[model samples]
Target: MVLKIGDARSMYRKFKPHLLMVLIQLGYTFLNFITEASFNEGLNPYVYITYRHAVSGFVMLPFAYFLERRIRPKLTWPLFVELFILSLLGVGFTLNAYFASLRYTSPTVVASMVNVISSLTFIIAIPLGMEKLDLKNPRGMAKVIGTLASLAGVTLMTLYKGKSFRSIWSAPIHMGSSSIHENWLKGSILGVASCITWSMWYVMQAYTLERYPAQLSLTTWMSLIGGAQSAVFTVCVEHKPAAWIIGFNIKLWSILYGGIVCSGLIIFIQLWCTKEKGPVFVTMFNPLSTIMVAILAYFVLGEGLYMGSILGGIIIIIGLYLVLWGKENDEEEVPMRSS
Candidate 1:
């Protein structure tokens, strides 16, 4: 009985990050949905994101200071610079582009597009010597295949919007009809740009975490720096004082939830997961959010569940499993090889 219990505990330890990340992604799906809804209600993307990062920074600062006080390393100038660059790439550019894209497209499109990040990360990591791509190794082959499959799934999702498999009761919120196709093309471009920057951020975070081992502290610093940068941008871009106003509406809710939950909690969870699992492992779960968003959007936004989306989601899921299996196999082999 003791041996069985020990085995169970070991299994739990091994899979705990995976389970935690799944829950986190589900939360993020809901948050993304809310963000889209807020955008439809005419919330300024710049102001919203600025508030998000600022609130997250304030919320996290005390916890990071208290929790990591003893073990936190000295805040050196070079380390500060690295954090600033990370903030610019990850929080500032990635999110600005993401929110901008949402203004032009549906949440479902944005969510499906994000699945490409896994593949992009894999590709970028290989070039950086952060990931191995040995064709002879089954694990490496699996990673390559998984990346290709994910890209293919995303492409299918973008190109084909087939008949609706299921219809919901909610009314669809239309932004506007003027330059709709052009806006969609523009949004797709920006979405891809966000994915690229996000992928870079994952790689940079993995490298940064090795040097600055305090996850909370690092995240706090990133949020603070990114927030300040975003504020500057907001001021320059948004001349009207009305743009910054947050009243009792979806805008207020978006700021509160985006800042507190998405920025603060989600970043902490992501950093912890990235530390435990590699960046690829953490990013592989993005497709799960795409699936969640699809279902949630259908019910809440009265969006149709299309046949193409269903088929694409299945392919994305298969790719996700393949990448995860490859990573797990690689990790298992490391111990044996070392032994």
Candidate 2:
């Protein structure tokens, strides 16, 4: 049977959900850039972190009860366990680790490390038997190469040394007297650690979705549990009497936006998309965030969008497309096996 151009176009329209999912990731990255800038202005990092999760949890609770309480599948003990662990891992530990790292590191360092999600998810998913490894396939090769290219782009964005590139590879790199090893090294370690923990959160979230599959409701519950956990941790470790004080009007609004829109809403969207599509499908869009963040940082925060960042962002986007195209042609079904 011959297909008309109109028929082909109509068929392509079915992928709207998938396309929307990719856009949502871009949305997240853009919002996150603003959130970071807002975070930098005032308010203690840990307290803001605490408040964001707390607001997310409290805001999501009533909605979860009303919108999803009845329709959600009955929760088994095992599934409940999974949800609890997911809450602790994805929300509690991940955010806590991230905020802690942020205290120690620059956002650029954190952003660079975030690219590790693609490689980490691919590597861990194989061992967990949640994804089949077909190293021989062109699609698989593309996934690997594309991820590396994306990382290279991120490296360029974060670590490009201009014509002084060789200097970065050499020892005793001076930043106006204080060496890079002396000042910037701690931040780099924290950034890498945050990335590993963040990857763990993604893997666990994927597994949790398999069993108790109500994405929004599950996320809401996790936010509640995890928020409480993080709040307690923050209170113990970082919060002071003054830390609870709302310092500025902008900071107040920033926390609200970060909590309600960025953390709560976006996470719900992420779970929905990642569950509907494969993890790789959701993850392939990670690099596109750099483009959005770079632009936003330039205009809103008055941070210079360096030439390396712009070029690297474009390369990263290209690599992500390559990864997505590779994923589309694969027929393998890697069921979310019990982790």
Best by lDDT: 1
Candidate 1 lowest-lDDT run of ten: 173-182
What is candidate 1's CA lDDT for residue 328? Answer: 80
lDDT of 1 by residue, 76-123 (tens): 899889998999988888888888887787777888888888888887
For 163-245, candidate 2 gives per-residue lDDT tens digits of 32221223321112211223366656766676676677777777777766777688777777777777787788864687778
Model 2, residue 313: C-alpha shift (Å): 1.9
Each candidate's number of clashing pairs is 0, 0
Global Cα RMSD, each model: 2.3, 6.8
Off-target runs (Cα >4 Å) in candidate 1 are: 168-182
Candidate 2 residues lying further than 4 Å off, grouped into runs, are 1-14, 75-77, 161-183, 331-339
